[model samples]
Target chain A: MSFTVEKTIKTCRGKLLKLSHNSAALNCKMVLNVYIPKQFYENASVAKNKIPSIFYLSGLTCTPENCTEKGFIQIQADKYGFAVIYPDTSPRNVTFPKDCKIDPNDWALGEGAGFYLDSDTLENFQMGTYISEELPQSLASSTDLFEDKIDFLKKRSIMGHSMGGMGALNFYLNSFERNSNGYVSCSAFSPVVNPTAVSWGQNAFKLYFKDYEHEGKKLDPTLILKNKDFSDKNLNILISSGDADPFLENQLKPQNLIDVVTKKNIKGIRVNIEPGYDHSYFFVSTFIPEHCEFHAKKLGLINHLIK
Target chain B: MSFTVEKTIKTCRGKLLKLSHNSAALNCKMVLNVYIPKQFYENASVAKNKIPSIFYLSGLTCTPENCTEKGFIQIQADKYGFAVIYPDTSPRNVTFPKDCKIDPNDWALGEGAGFYLDSDTLENFQMGTYISEELPQSLASSTDLFEDKIDFLKKRSIMGHSMGGMGALNFYLNSFERNSNGYVSCSAFSPVVNPTAVSWGQNAFKLYFKDYEHEGKKLDPTLILKNKDFSDKNLNILISSGDADPFLENQLKPQNLIDVVTKKNIKGIRVNIEPGYDHSYFFVSTFIPEHCEFHAKKLGLINHLIK
Candidate 1:
C-alpha cells in the first residue's frame, strides 16, 4: 500500500498531494492526486469527524493532472471540508501488449482511454475493480496522512466529466451498489450518457470486452440501470450537460439517461442542461461547487446549507 | 484596433473571451483573455456604473491560457463585479528575424519570456508598452460587448504572479505613474521585486536593453522605486510570497521590495510571506481573492464587506 509522493502543492486552504503507487489491479504503476482540505489540518484530534472524500475521474485523453489543474475543485473542497481524489484515466505502463485486442495507436482504446472498466480480454487492466474497490481500499489503509481520518472507502461520493461521467454512473449503479459502504452520491458534467450507443464507447467496449461471456453488457450504465436494484442507493444522483457542447447530440446524449430514469420512475435523479456552456473543463468547473454541496449534504459532512 | 474573438467560454456567472489583435507596439500579434463578469450582462443600460478591470500578467514561459485556466480569477471577478484581462507573456509571429539581441534558444530571454517590457534592442517586442498602454486603448475602443462599459482605462488595476508580478510593480510604479488615468491598485503573488539583482531579471534586462542609452537603468523596479515619486499613488500595493517557493531567495527576492518600502517609508504597501506555498499557480490562485477584494474596494465596485 506504499505510495510515493511526487509533489505536494499548496492550494486554497489545503494541499494537493500528487502520488503514484504500484497497482495490483492494473498490474502497473498508477498515478493519482489527492487534495486534503484545511479542516483536516485544523483538527487537533486525528479521528475527529473523518473527512468525506469525493473521487473525480477524468475523461478521455486525460491524466490526473488535467482535472487537478483545470477543474478548480480544490477551492470548493476547501469550502466544503471534504477531500478530493483525482484518479488517472488509465494505467501508464501496461505490460500485456499482446493480450490487448485494441491497437496502441487508437486514441479511444489504449492507454489514455481506459473507459474505467476491467477488460475481459487478456489485456485486462481491471480499471473498474481498481476504481471501485482496490483504489479506495488502498487509499483508506495507507498510513500516510493518517488515512483512517479520511473516509475514502465508506463515506465517499463520485463525480466525473465526459467519459468519466459514464464510469461514475456505471460504477454507482452496478459495482458500487454491491459494496456495503459504497458511494453516497454521484454527479457528472457533459458525460457520455449512452456510451454503448456512441462510437467512442462502442470502440472502447469492442476492444476491452471482445471475448467475454457477459461481453460489454455489464459495463453499460443504460443497460445496468434497468437490471440493477438501486434500493440501497439513497442519495440523489445529479447530471449536467452543456447545450452548446458539440458532442451533446452524437456522443453525450444525456436525454437517453433522462428517458431511462423517467420510464423506470427512478427516484432522486436530476439532469440539468446548461445553456451556452461547452464540453470543456470550464463547463465542469463552473458547476462543480453545486455538485460538491450536493455530495457534502449526502456524505453527512454538512447538515446545514452553505452560502 | 480590431481584435479577433478566438473562443468565448462560459464560466461561473461570466464568460472568458480569448482574443487576438495586431499590436502596433510589439510589431506582432498579441493574444489575451478577457473575462466579463455577470454584472456587465446584468446591467440593462450602458451607464449603470461601468465594471472595473483587473490586468493579470503571467509568469515566465506562460501564455494567456495558462493563467486563464489555472489562475481561477474568473469566479472572483464575478463575485466582485470586476472584469479581468489576462495578457500573453510575449509576442508571437515576430516578422523581424534579426531585430533582437537574445538567442531564440534561451528560455529566459526570448519568446515566452518577454519579461513584460519593451526592448531597445532590435528584438524588442515592446510588451511593456503593449500591456500598459496599447492593449487597454484597443480593448476600450472595440465595440464587441460594448467594451466601452468596461473600465479598462481609468478605473483599472493590476495583479500578477512571478515575472508578471515584476511587470505589475514596475509598471505601477513607473510607466503607469505617468498616465493621467492609470491603475488604481496593484498586487503580486511571488513577484520578482528586485529584477536587476536576479539572474532572471539580469538576463532579460541585458538582452532587451543591450547597448541602449537607458540600458538596464529603466527596467528595474527597485531602481525606479527609489528614483520615482509615488506621492500621487493612492491605492494600497499588496504582495504575497510563499516561504517554500524555491526561487524565493535568489530569483523572487520579495524582501528587497519590503526593505525598499520600509526604508522609503512608503505608505499603503503590504508584503506577506505565506507558509509552505510554492511557485505554482496554486499559490497564486490561493491569494488571488484577497487581491481582488483590495482592488474592488479601491475601484468602488463594492462598498460593503464580502464574505
Candidate 2:
C-alpha cells in the first residue's frame, strides 16, 4: 500500500507530487498527482488539525499530468488550505481482461476513458471503485506521503472537467448519505451530466459494460438527480460550463441536470454559463477561484486575506 | 500587413487571441499569441486610453503556445490591464537560406533557438530585428488585430524564461537608448544570464553567426552588462532563478551577472534565488503575479484592487 514518489516539483506555496502505487481494487499500478497545500508544509509533523482534501478528476484522454500542469488548480488549492488530488481517469500500463472489449484506436473509449465508474463487465476498468473507494482507503494510511497531515475522510469535495464533470456530479449524487464523512460539495466544468443521452457516454457505456440498461442508469447523474435525497446531504454543488464549449449542445447537455434540479426544486446547486470560454484549460483556470471559494465555504474555511 | 486569427479564447477578464501574420523581418509567416486584457473589452473602440503591452519570450523548443497554455501570465495581464504579446521563438513556415550552417537535427541551433538576436551569417533568422524593431512597427498599424487599442511602442516591458530570459535582459540593455519608445523594465525566470560562458549559449552563438567574438559578444547579456551605461534609462531589472534548477550551476551562471551588478554598483536590479523552485512553468506561474506587478509599476499602472 506504500506509494512511490516519482517526482516532486515545487509550485505555488506547496509542492506537486507525482506518485505511483499498486491498487488492489483495479489490480494494477496506478499513478496520480497530489498537490499538497502550503498549510501542510507550515506544519508537516504537527498533525493536530489536518488539511482537508479536494479530489479533481481529469477529463478524457488525460493522465494526471493535464490538469496538474495546465489547469492551474494548484493556485486555488493553496489559496484555500485544501490538498488537491489529481487522480488518473483510467488504469494504464496493465493488461486488460480477455472477456472485456476495448478500442485501441479510439481515445474516447479505452485507456483514458474510464468515465469514473465500476465496469459492469471486468475488474480491469473498475475506476469507479478505485477512485471513490480503494484510493481513499490507501491514502488514509499513507503516512510516508503526507505524514498524516491530510484529512481524507472528512471535509472534502469532488470536481472534474468535461467527461470528468459527469464523474464528479454522479459521484457526488450517488455517494450521498453514505456516511458523515461524505463529500461536502461537488463541482464541474463543461461536464457530461447525462451519459445515457450523449454519444461519448453511449459509446463508453456500451463498451465498459455488456449493456447500458443494467448499470448505466445508476451511474448517470441526470437520472440520480431526479430521485436524489437532499434531506440529509448538503447539496453544495457548483457547475461552470463554457457557452462556447463545442460539445455543450450534444455531449454535455447541462440542461438535462438543470431541468431535473429545477423540476425537483433542488437547492444550492449553481450553474454558471461563462461567456466566450471554451472547453480548454483556459476556461477551467479562469473559474478556479470561484470554484475553490465554493468548496472552501462548504469545507468551512474562514479566510479573510486570501479566498 | 493583415493578420489571421487562428483562435480566440476567453480567460479571466480577457481573451487570448491566437494570431498569425507575415513577418518581413524574419522573411516568413509567423504565429504569435496576444492576450488582450479586460480593459480592451471594456471599450475596444475607444482608442483614447490604449492598454500597455508586455512581450513575453519563451525558452528552448517552445512555440508561443507553451507559455500561453501553461504560464498563467494572462491572469496577471488581466489584473493589471495590459495585453501580453507571446511572439514566436523564430520564423515558421519558411525556407532556410543556403550557407547559413543551420543544424536541422539540433533544436538548440535553428528554429526555436532564435536567441532573440540578428544572425551575422544570414537574413533567414534575424529574430533580433524581428522582435525589437519590425514586430512593434507592424503592431502599430494593426487596426484589424488590436484596433490601435494596444500601445505597442510605448509603456512596454520585456520578460522571458530560460533562454528567453537571456534575450529579455540583452534586449533591455541594448535597446535602452533607442528612443522614448524603449522598454521600461526587464525580468526573467531561470534565464541564461551569461550565455557566452555556457554550453547552451555558446552552441547557439556559434551556429547563429560565423564567429563568437564578433557576434556573440554583442548578443550576450553578461558581455553587454560589463560595458553598459544606465545613465538616463530606468534599470528596473528582476531575475528569479531556482536553486534546484539542474541548469543553474553550469548553464545559467547567475553569479556572472551578480558580480558585474555588485562591482559596478548597479541599482534597481534585484536577483532573487528562490528556494525549492525549478525551471518549469510551475515556477514561472507561481512568480507571475510578482513579475506583473514589477512591470505594472514600470508601465505606470496603479491597481489597488488587483496587482
Best DockQ among the predictions, by candidate number: 2
Instruction: Provide DockQ values for all models, in the order shown.
Output: 0.81, 0.83
- The residue-by-residue lDDT of candidate 1 on B1-307, one tens digit each, is 7889988888888898989888888877778899998878875733667878999999888998888888888888888888899999988866544544556677776788888887877444788788888999898889675557888888889998899998888778774557555688899989988888889988877777765336555666677777776767664689999999999999998778778777887788888999999999888888888888888888886763355
TM-scores of the candidates in the order shown: 0.95, 0.96
lDDT of 1 by residue, A113-151 (tens): 989988876354678888988888888888766457888
Flag regions of model 1 displaced more than 4 Å: A45-47, A95-105, A122-124, A211-213, A231-235, A304-307, B95-103, B175-177, B211-215, B304-307
Task: Give the per-residue lDDT digits (tens) of candidate 2, residues B1-307.
Answer: 5678898888888888888888888878899998998888778433566788999999988999999989999888877788999998987766667756667888886888889988877677888888888888788788877888898887788999999999898888887555535788899999999888988888888776788767888777777878866655558999999888999999999989999888888787899999999999989999999999999888878643442
- Native-referenced DockQ of model 2: 0.83
Instruction: State residue B213's C-alpha deviation in candidate 1, in Å.
Output: 9.1
Relative to the real complex, the DockQ score for model 1 comes to 0.81
For residue A168, model 1's alpha carbon misses the true position, in angstroms, by 0.9
